[model samples]
Target: MSWLALWLLGAGLCDLAHSVRPARHLPSAVGAAGTLLFGLLAGLSSGADLAALPLLAGAVAGWGYLVTFGFGRGRAPMALAGYAVVTGLLLLIAQQAGAVGGAFGRWVESTPLPVLAERDPEQVLLLLAVLVAQMSTGNVIVRLVLAATGTVNPGKGPDATSTLKGGRLLGPMERVFIVGLGVAGHATAASIVVAAKGLLRWPELQARRDAATGPSIDDVTEYFLVGSFVSWLWALGGLVLLA
Candidate 1:
């Protein structure tokens, strides 16, 4: 659970750093160092073997650095690959150390908060991570997919400008709604969110359709379709992790 929290914290902070302009590297560096320190403390507090500390610190720090670097450079594929590899390795290590059932779990179980009384700390940490991922991290991932598939390009172009306008706010809200609905076993209701987005954007999309300049309708539609799908997938993936 601690590892999971640390992983999420590292990833989230790195993504946050990537989202900020000017002095991005500073946050990335600080985030990586913070993750390492917190990871070490978490490990020790959880009674994990001292011998595993180095590997744990290395994994957390490396994840932060790689994610920050990859996103900063617009290397979506590299960031995605790094995430997979590092998270996989961390999961394996956690399994070996039996790190999921420790002080955090006990505390979560004993908590008085009605909302969390029945939930484990792992679930809570995972939800927190998912929420964080739904922010800039999710946007970065969607853009990466779009770029990789040639559906969009980065710049001040029509599609890019349109997305840049409100996507940062909308993406996180939709993801949180989707994940929340799915967690509550109301997945069918989640479709309303998808519909609402389309309806709300219909006016804007229509307005753009007849514009004398900017990207073609095809490019805009493709960007919307691909980006929305990828964003929703992130939320669904979080649901899977929770399960």
Candidate 2:
């Protein structure tokens, strides 16, 4: 029943809500609840029975519980890995969802929401979910990776990755651009975007080498590289789903 799309929609909404409040350690119960509500609406609107409710609610709850209990602990890497594995599993199964499928997709097509009604609703919903997830959830996921794998510091924090600025904003913009390009059949052009980021940040990295505080030059570089790669992968993964 469009489990993949439904889960992505739920996870995206959860991250979005958390991002708005700007709290990393906070739980995403609201988003979880939102998922259930969307499921219920989609089911009812599409004239489907409520039999899928138990599974739907359980899945959303489990995801929410994982994310809610995972962060801010010493197990960031483990938690991140778990999340990735689940996402991959979902993506694998998403293909099994037949066309015109997912009560959500049908319900979306039934709406008077202009533009949205005319296209493949499942694709649109999935695309929208990816875009929304990239906006906030992408940043959070990168942060999780950085927190665990950031460069080593003897007397300082593991990462102290706040040396470079504007990444939170820049990462999302670049990801959206890449996803859009991929979806538009210009995937090869994404290399330009990748190159552009390195060129643009070269000066900042150089300047950080002489900075009086924060992570060392190498640490900052590692932070940038790791975060950037993760962000790119997240975006590319979404593009793959679209493909």
Number of the predicted model whose lDDT against the real structure is largest: 2
Off by over 4 Å in 2: 22-27, 44-53, 95-119, 152-162
Tens-digit per-residue lDDT, 174-201, candidate 2: 9999998987779999999999999988
Per-residue CA lDDT of model 1 for 53-126, tens digit only, reads: 45554555565566556645457688688777766776666654434345555666778976567666656666
Q: What Cα-based lDDT does every candidate model obtain? A: 0.67, 0.70
- Provide the lDDT at 48 for model 2: 36
C-alpha lDDT (0 to 100) for residue 212 of candidate 2: 74
> Which residue pairs in candidate 1 have backbone atoms (N, alpha carbon, C) closer than 3 angstroms, thus clashing?
none
RMSD of each: 3.3, 4.2
What lDDT does candidate 1 reach at residue 14?
A: 66
